[model samples]
Target: MKQLISYAVAALSLVATQAAAAPVTYYIQSEPYETVSNFTACPLGGCTVKYAKSNRISGSITLVAPLGSNLTDEDIDLQIHSFSISDGQNTYTDAQFFVDVFAQSARVSTDSAGNLTSFEFKFDKTHGTPYGEASYADSKAKVSYIWISSAPSPGAAVAASNSTCQFRGDNVNGNTNGAGCMMAYDTDSQGASSASTTGVTMSLTPPPAPTPVPTLSEWAMILLGVLLTGAAALNLHRRRQTA
Candidate 1:
């Protein structure tokens, strides 16, 4: 009985030791999308969202994952920290744009088996203008922006002649939740805005599962102990029967 208990403890110890550590992988899935499928608001509560309801608009989202693909706080910070957006005219850049940029959003992707494989990140307005000394703002104001068809309303927008920067803020009336704004700079667009660059998509994926190996030294030791304990128990039982 004592031998059986000892072997059991040994086996548990081996598993615990092996389970202590795991390697994490990092990689960028794709360029950040201008708009996700059902997302039209800033999911990460505090980020400022600009609501634009323009019929025709055009812009480009340039997202860079400075770190690998961990998406940790540092990764997120770096992602936002190294971001730049342009409509061939106005541009924005701010390091503190990561303000309140959190994860827990409904923007996620799934595998063919219907499993949650990865999730889309959230963004907030980083700055208002080029010389804006202030960097970030709190998540307090739940301002409901209204986008109308024919007219432009009171909202933070970077407008241009043949081009329009409507993607800077989220269209709350449209129920969109993506506002990753950092710094701001405006340029003159020579051509009109197109629908082509409006839907840039990007996602962060998780590392694959670790594979099993038959020659694992630690696992081998655990197996050996179990085999020996069973043999000893059997041998003791035989001796008692003979006695």
Candidate 2:
């Protein structure tokens, strides 16, 4: 009788698993048609303009329990990956950006001579809504990028070290801020000669909500199973006594 009850429990467990649904998956990407700005450290007591003119910003996001498997703003954890940002000449990887943004840190990408190429100071996810109506909702997350001149800049050399403003410098930090030289960067996003294309997209649908516990019918069936097994045991005992 005990063995019968155990078997019934195992059978119910299987049913519960089969009834449970899998969270769907969705692929997301975006295009930030905006220009970002950054300011270099005033080593010489002056600030230089640095900007990341977004050439193309795209990535994919996996959302759980999303409607229409749509990746909308929800109280769910987001697993975003495969992101890339480019400014025609230089490119920034997702690892160098999102990891720091989610971790509440800072990331800088540069070439040789410690010159800033593209850097993200603030991570903002409120920019564009890339989705369709009644299809799936999406969070229009956008981060601005600034474009800067290459390493060994002439302005840094001319301004930092010259008769106008005599200043000393050395390569203490890596390619981040142009070796303590104030550098001016340019990012033009609002103009006729700007990048025009479709917005960043988060397609391939998304995941659904997780399954809840078993229903009332399932519990009733469990009770029925116990009762039937107990009854069978009683009948078997009676037969044995008659024999």
Please list the C-alpha lDDT of all candidates, in the order they appear.
0.31, 0.31
Kindly provide the TM-score of model 2 when superposed on the true structure, using C-alpha atoms: 0.25
lDDT of 1: 0.31
- The residue-by-residue lDDT of candidate 2 on 40-118, one tens digit each, is 2222221222323443433233323223232222122232333433334234454653232221112334344423343
Q: In candidate 1, what are the lDDT values of residues 1-243, reduced to their tens digit?
A: 999999999999998766533222232222222321112333323322222232222222233422233332222322232433332223333443334321212133345543323433333332223212211132222211111111111111222222212334432222223442222212112122221112222223532433556578878898999999999999999999999
Q: Candidate 2: where is the Cα deviation over 4 Å?
A: 1-24, 29-56, 64-99, 102-200, 205-243
Give the runs in model 1 whose Cα sits over 4 Å from its true position. 1-26, 31-118, 128-243
Candidate 2: lDDT over CA atoms? 0.31
Q: Whose TM-score is greatest here?
A: 2
